[model samples]
Target: MRARALVPGVPALLPSYASLDDPVAPLRAACLSAVGELGPRVRVVASGPSGRRVGAALAEAVGAVVVDADETGTLVVGNGSATRTEKAPGHLDERAAGFDAALRASFDHIDLALADELWADVTCLVGLPPLADGDVRYDDAPYGVQYWVAVWG
Candidate 1:
């Protein structure tokens, strides 16, 4: 691939979900910058419809077109863990930290069952290279959701 990017599939990143204060400003900026680096034609890899929509939105915002073939870039949408805190969507799974840490190490071997329990969106990450192989722009569990904005070439 000429260019590749990884971003969380958070609905907050969408323009339609914009709030007055913008809770995800930094993440949005990072996503936009990574997406902007992608060429005009991008192929989006996402686990579900929401994730797909988020990828499409980011690509569109950067003036990139979502394509099925002849892609100049690839946008992969997924995240680590969602049960990082008590208020997390998955409600504080004690195993979240370890699971996310292992995931950060490599995406080559993921336990789908455990991932599901922790609310991790990693299905689209199956064939992609490790995140450590790229430039990680953001890595945090803001609002209890583990998010990473990374890029590869």
Candidate 2:
């Protein structure tokens, strides 16, 4: 399964996405112009601890789906290694587990740094999804563990 998220730093956003299967690339590329940024890569918690990595950790983990990344925005997740699970601006009670692979952040072991310039306004993404049962994804059937890391615009 594949998920795509849109942390659109702009108003007229397009289809932002995070995917697991190979079919997600085209959909992601198609919305680049409209969204102004590309998606970053994260990992699935269910995939394992070592695989749960990502870029733009600060923004990816907390920022809203449509918040501005400029001015009051925080680029703490900037192209750095220590920011694998950086928290966003308004996060007050984030836990170690919550920041690393919580939600859908852990999916594909992300290495996409901000400097990579995959896209313009987009941030990070992963191939994992958090199960509704409050557990990490373990199945590789596309919908299992890759749900949290990816979402759609």
Candidate 3:
């Protein structure tokens, strides 16, 4: 399976929800660039309908099509935590940084309880193929949210 990309489920990534001056312009650019590499037919894996919409918007931005079957590549949408700082979406949680750090190291074993408390959206990440150091295209905690955009062939 050619897994093309991994993006965060950030609502701001969607054009419909975009602001006059995008707060995540750089992040959006990165996401589009990554999605463009996924070829024409892409399969989207997300936690819910909202996430699916974000994925679809991203695919559209890159002139890619979201497919349910016979996809050329897979796009997994998820993120680490929303409670990394005081101004974070979920506000600061003492355990947020550690949880996100562990996820960055490896998405294999996760603490469900901690994830919930930290407002992490990692359900779609579990059991996914491992990402190599070189495969990581974007890795940061911008806006106190841990987001990654990695690709694998």
Candidate 4:
């Protein structure tokens, strides 16, 4: 139960979305490094099926098995606002930056309604300890989607 990690459930991280040039190379490396630290058993918490798939792939990539209970580590998949820019998946939302800023400060209080409007998958993000208690390996909005790769050990 010591290991904990959070990675955005971006399709770009999945093999199915892999490109010959590898658009998300740095993100993949950060995810692998973080997921590698989780022991042999990992409990994955994701907002939806797609996120679950991403978590499963990451855990398997590191030789870890996804377990339902009694896991040695936990992988929570989620992300902040996706409407950060004009090219964002959900398109630009004027409230996105402020929303993401609040999230960065604390996951303690989240505007679920606004999150949905901004296309943020934060259902699994609630109740986590805090990013301040861990190391944030990656935090950027590449492709206009806010993604974070963090681990707590």
Strongest candidate by lDDT: 1
TM-score of each prediction: 0.97, 0.17, 0.94, 0.97
Clashes of 1: 0
Clashes of each: 0, 36, 0, 0
lDDT of 4 by residue, 1-153 (tens): 379999999878888888999988899999999998889999999989999999999999899999999898999999999999999999999999999888887888899999999999999889877788889999899988898899999
lDDT by residue for model 1 over 1-153, one digit each (tens)?
Answer: 589999999999888899999999999999999988889999999989999999999999999999998999999999998999999998999999999998888888899999999999999877677878998888999889899989998
User: Candidate 4, 107: how far from true, in Å?
Assistant: 0.6
lDDT of 2 by residue, 112-134 (tens): 44312222111333432323422
Backbone collision tally, model 2: 36
Residue pair clashes in candidate 1: none
Q: Write the per-residue lDDT of candidate 3 for residues 1-153, one digit (tens) a residue.
A: 565688999999887888999988888878888888889998999999988999999998888899999998888899899898898989999888888888888889989888988888899999766666427878888888889888776
RMSD of 3: 1.3
Q: After superposition, how far is residue 64 of candidate 4 from its true place, in Å?
A: 0.7
Rank order by TM-score, top first?
1, 4, 3, 2
Q: lDDT for model 3, please.
A: 0.86
User: Scored by CA lDDT, what does every candidate get?
Assistant: 0.92, 0.26, 0.86, 0.91
